[model samples]
Target: MSMLEPQAPDLRVQKWIGADGESTGPLKLSDLGSGPKILFAFQHWCRGCHVHGFPTLQRLHSALSPRGVGFAVIQTVFEGADENTFEKLRVNQLEYALPVAFGHDEPLVGATLPTFMEDYRTRGTPWFSIIDAGGRIVFSDFHLDADRIVKDLELV
Candidate 1:
C-alpha cells in the first residue's frame, strides 16, 4: 500500500514477550495517548529494516520519547521457520528502547508483518504510523524521517 492511505481504523494488537523475554504489547495506534504515539512495524530478518529502518526508528524514539511521544515496535518472524534460524535472529541488539513484541507470541492476533501486508495492504517493512492522543492517525508512511519526526514533535 502507498504510505498515504489511512490505516484500518479498528486494527487491534496484543501484548507479548520478545526474543529478549521482555513484555510487549500488540498495541493499537489509537490506544496510545497522554501524548502522541509512533508505531514502527518491523521484522528481524529484513535487511533493509535492520540497516536503515531500525536505526532511523532509534533516532526518532530517542528524540521524541522524552517529549511525551510513545514509541513501540513489532518484530515479526515468518510463520514457517525452524528453531535454528529463528533463534539466531535477535531483537535486543536493535538500538531503540521502545517496548517490543514478536509474531510468535500467543496474543499476536495474526498481525505479523506478512499478515499486516495482507491485512493492512502494505507491501514492506518499516511501516510507520503516528497516532494522536485522541486515537486519530495523523501520519502513516513506509519511510521514516528521523529528523522530521523529531522536529515535528517539537512544534506539537
Candidate 2:
C-alpha cells in the first residue's frame, strides 16, 4: 500500500450513513462509483484517529471535493463493537459537520479484523487510501501528505 504500488481492495460496507446523516442500508464495493475516491478508515475510540486522522480527512474533503474528488469515512470495528457502533457514524457526521457518506465495516463471522484491514492489509485505524478514477488504489498508508495527494488528484 505504497505510492508506487496500490491495491484495489473491495469496499464491503455493512451500512452507510447518508448525506442526511441517517442509515442508507447495506452496500457493496461496486456501489461507490468509478472514482478518484478518498476512503479513510477509523475507529471511534482510537486517539490518533480522533486527534489527527479525522481532521486530516475533513481538511482533505474541504480542499479536494470542489475538484470532483469523492470522499468516504469507514469505521472499521476490529475491536470494541460497543464503542464503534453504527450510531457513531451519525455522531461523527454531526460532530464534524460533513455531509459525505460514512460506513460501518465489521469483521466477518469468526474473524478478528474487519474486511478493510484484512483485504487491504491495513495495519490499523487512521489508515487512508486513495483510489484512482478507474478504481485502482493510488495511495494507501497511515500518513497522508495532503499537498501531494491534492497534486496527484489532478492526474486522476
Candidate 3:
C-alpha cells in the first residue's frame, strides 16, 4: 500500500516517555497551537535514520522550534528494552533538543511493525508526518529537507 493521504481531524498518537524520561501526551496534533508539528518516526538501528533523518530532524528542530513549531522524534521499536539500551541509542547525535519517544514504552495502540508497514505503506526509516496547528496534516514524506521543510512550514 502507498502512504495514506492526509486525513481530517488530528492523528491520535499514543503517549510515551521521552528520552529524558518525561511523560508526555500522544504527540497530539491539536497541541501544536497555530504553528506546525513535525513528527519523525524512526528506529535507532536504521542506518539511514541515524545518518540522514536525525541530523535533518535536528536542523529542523533548531530552525523551527523557536518559531513556535513543535518538533518530536518517535523512535518506533518492537523490543521493550531498558533505559541503558535506550541511552545507548545515541539520541544525542541529533544535536538538538528534540524529544524522542519509543514504542517499547508506549506501543502504538492497535499498531505493530507489520501493521504500520502496511498502514503507512513504507519500507524505510524516517517516515515523517507534519500536522498544522489546526489539527490537519499538511505534509507527509519519508525523507527530510531542512530548508524546504522550514519554508514549507513557513518558518523562514
Q: Pick the candidate with the highest lDDT.
A: 2
Please provide, for model 2 over 3-77, each residue's C-alpha lDDT reduced to its tens digit, 9 standing for 90 to 100: 565657677677897879877876555555656788889988989988989888888888888887878888999
lDDT-best of 1 and 2: 2
TM-score of each: 0.67, 0.88, 0.67
Per-residue lDDT of 28-145 in model 1, one digit per residue for the tens? 5444446877766666557777688878877887778778886656544444234313333244433444443433311245544444444444455667777766555677668867
In model 1, the worst 10-residue window by lDDT is: 80-89
Q: Output the better candidate (2/3) by TM-score.
A: 2
Summarize candidate 3's per-residue lDDT along 24-64 as a digit string, tens digits.
Answer: 55544445456677777666666777688878887887778
Q: Relative to the unseen true structure, what is the C-alpha lDDT of residue 68 in candidate 2, on a scale of 0 to 100?
A: 79
Per-model lDDT: 0.57, 0.82, 0.59
User: Which of candidates 1 and 3 is the stronger one according to lDDT?
Assistant: 3
- What lDDT does candidate 1 reach at residue 7? 42
Q: Which ranges in model 2 have alpha carbons more than 4 Å from their true place?
A: 1-7, 28-31
TM-score of 3: 0.67
lDDT over C-alpha atoms for residue 109 of model 1: 50
